[model samples]
Target: MLRDSVTAASADRAARGRAARKRVPRSAHGTWIPAADRPDPVGLLQAQGRDRLPELLPVRYARMAASPLAFLRGGAAVMAADLAAQPHTGLTVQLCGDAHLLNFGLYAAPERPLLFDLNDFDETFPGPFEWDVKRLAASVAVAARENGHKEEHVFGAARAAAGQYREAVRRLARQGELTVWYQHIDADLLLPLVRSGRRRRRTEATLTRARRRTSLQALGKLTETVGGRRRIIHDPPLLEPAGAMDTASLRKIFSDYRSTLPEERRLLLDRYRFVDAARKVVGVGSVGVRCFIVLLSGRDADDPLFLQIKQAGPSVLEEHLPSGPYVHPGRRVVAGQRLMQAAGDAFLGWTTGPEGRAFYWRQLHDMKASADVAGMSPGELRAYARLCGTALARAHARSGDRVAIAAYLGGADTFERAVGDFALRYTERNADDHAALGAAVVAGVVPAAPGV
Candidate 1:
């Protein structure tokens, strides 16, 4: 019996070693990358992003790639794959998939406080937690470069980001239940926490700007005076003029989606009567896919609500993470989005449309806001990056094995160096992808109007 026990233990150890050995592929630095492969990280994402561009306005595409910085802003999908190939402690979590500098911002929580957490989770999934951190770090380095900061500052910010992630995870690992429950980052409390004078001014300015991004502002800009009435109009080949969706078809899709939601969510949605629905263009990377906004109004005209039904493609992180065969990619996206976001759109749902196209639906504008990284000064960038880092730690802590991660990170600078190295390399790769997209536009492969 003793010999048999010894043999079983030996076999288990051997199996674990073999699996680990198979998992760790070589990195860009020539070391074994235990998470995913090194090269071709951007292949699937680039293909998907390119296909989605025609849905964008001609002017929007030009504007999205107007500058290297702008181009970098639009290419989160491409950057994700590069970061996924690095060495990590194998701690999986529901990642934000595209947690760049621009993805963080203020939103109204159910409590009415200006709460901040990851806002976009379309590409989210259970994967190596470092992929999200690495993406955020690379964006900081690149955005810092765009703002004319020196390399040292960029590297410093990257290291600070990793340090915060490691420290936060370690702290969370040892925290009492109440301590973990009580933590939340309010934008109002941020100015005092940021030490840099330049950064403080930037944060103040950003806060002021975010306050200006109200529902009324969005309505004013997106809607127009049509036939002596204000309405959301579609501009052809650019903004799909509002009549794009057939009313019958929309109801059918929504009905199918309704069947997929939980009983409580389905009942909550009964309050919303879909008024007008139309397909619209949104972000640069997410262009070309079918995205529609459903206008919902209650008894009074003033009681208006909006919901966005977006098609969910295969995860950009799936190539890196373990996603057992999904019957519907939209379900995977909705699940990941729910896992990562502290508070999500109340009406979020998922359905597989015609031809097996996967899609997830949510509130179109539930008080969403984003950082204007283009306008931020260097100091502001650093402070904002730190905030992003801390928030990322919180998100990772929600679904990942924090204890094992903290143990692997154990007072060592591996988290810092590994991500910093990825940031530097991947930033260069971003520039290249941006250039390629620019060339494609120049070759007339894609269309965009001037001042876009």
Candidate 2:
């Protein structure tokens, strides 16, 4: 009876996927037109910062105004509102919410292979799967243009990402549950893709750098001996020591966060005594949030571990989509990360921070790495785009009806082509929005601190 029930449910889901195409045809996905009453992009960005620290707001504005690509990275709220106004195929999935090209990267876990997957989850929520696909495509287009690629190359890169997303989703649809669940993109997969000698060496070097990005490696760069003991160095506006009050707050929250972890991880965590901590700035979108780095030592001074405690806010997609399972913002981020990543972090957890704000804890850098999109050649960018697309499709399969999405996408390139068209059109608006932020800075409407 259980097996019969499961099969019947899947059949109905597949039928629902196919039925969605009638209401919003796959061809409709290619179009992008701004609504008459679209909210002011700058106003949307400012509204998201209502709860953020006032001091670091300038840094966020500066980083976002640096370039069009940077604007796209930080403008998730603006993009979310725009996409909500568009017609979408109703195949819902747990979206990364901000699935830009850079967000998909190499993530390393203890004792497991280095797998590439979506690493950022601040805006993760369940919504139409195509929203993520469109965002990814738009990011590729913007990056390609910034890299000075011609029109043909730009379209090619965008189409490549969308095409791979469609194909990967279709392949997963044909797979059984465990197969899709267990699937991971091993770092070794990158080796075969780069056939040329020079590119191979570059790729190898990048991988080598990632392997060395552990907490032990960070000891020298982020800290120094101060009066015969290691302490986090003060870098002013970016990295500063969490003073007495913040330090005490962190200590009190430690026990609450520790209980959220698994028993084994909690035991392992107990071995390391907290030594020093600092307030650190991170990411374009996450700049003004309360993010802190903790230093822990184990066995001896040589052994070290770094953990990041980042404040969590409501997802940018929350207003447009139905309410999700998690009521707490921090728990939502941790849960979404666990569901999407093939092999999730053992130390990931969430808890309430000072003033009842939500925050999540995770290992700072377990050998993480992201691609250098600014330097990629056109061919390399296209290949990287396709790989990112494949990885995203794999993540979606874990939380959505894969068979239904595949049926809606069909066995054709129509979806990909349409998305490519949409990406090109969308980037035009992104350019104007980016300019608007810069113009606001010039007009003194909002203060900015450049080159941070």
By lDDT, who's the top model here? 2
lDDT of 2 by residue, 1-452 (tens): 99999888878878888899898888888878999999999999888888998899999999999999999999999999999998777788999999999898887866757878899999999999999999999999999999999999999999999999999999999889999999999887776667668888888887888888888999888999989999988998899999999988999999999999999999999999999999999999899999999999999989999999999989999999899999999999999999998888888999898899999999888878887788678888899999999999999999998999998988889889999999999899999999999999999887799888
Off by over 4 Å in 2: 1-10
Q: Any idea what lDDT model 1 has?
A: 0.66
Off by over 4 Å in 1: 1-46, 49-64, 84-88, 176-183, 193-221, 224-230, 236-238, 242-245, 260-265, 324-326, 445-450
lDDT of each: 0.66, 0.91
Q: What's the TM for model 2?
A: 0.97
Give residue 284's error in model 1 in angstroms: 1.8
Mind giving the per-residue lDDT tens digits that candidate 1 earns over 1-452? 99899667545543543344235421222232334444442344346655454545455557656765666656655565555545444556777888876778777665656767777777777777767877788788788777777787877777677778878877886665456645667878667655768767776776766665544455555566666544565765545544644445567788888877789878877776766666677775566677776666665545666667788887777776676345577887777766666665567788876556787887665556776666465566666777888888877777775655665565666557656766666667667766766776788765667543
In terms of TM-score, the best-performing candidate is: 2
Models 1 onward score TM values of: 0.82, 0.97
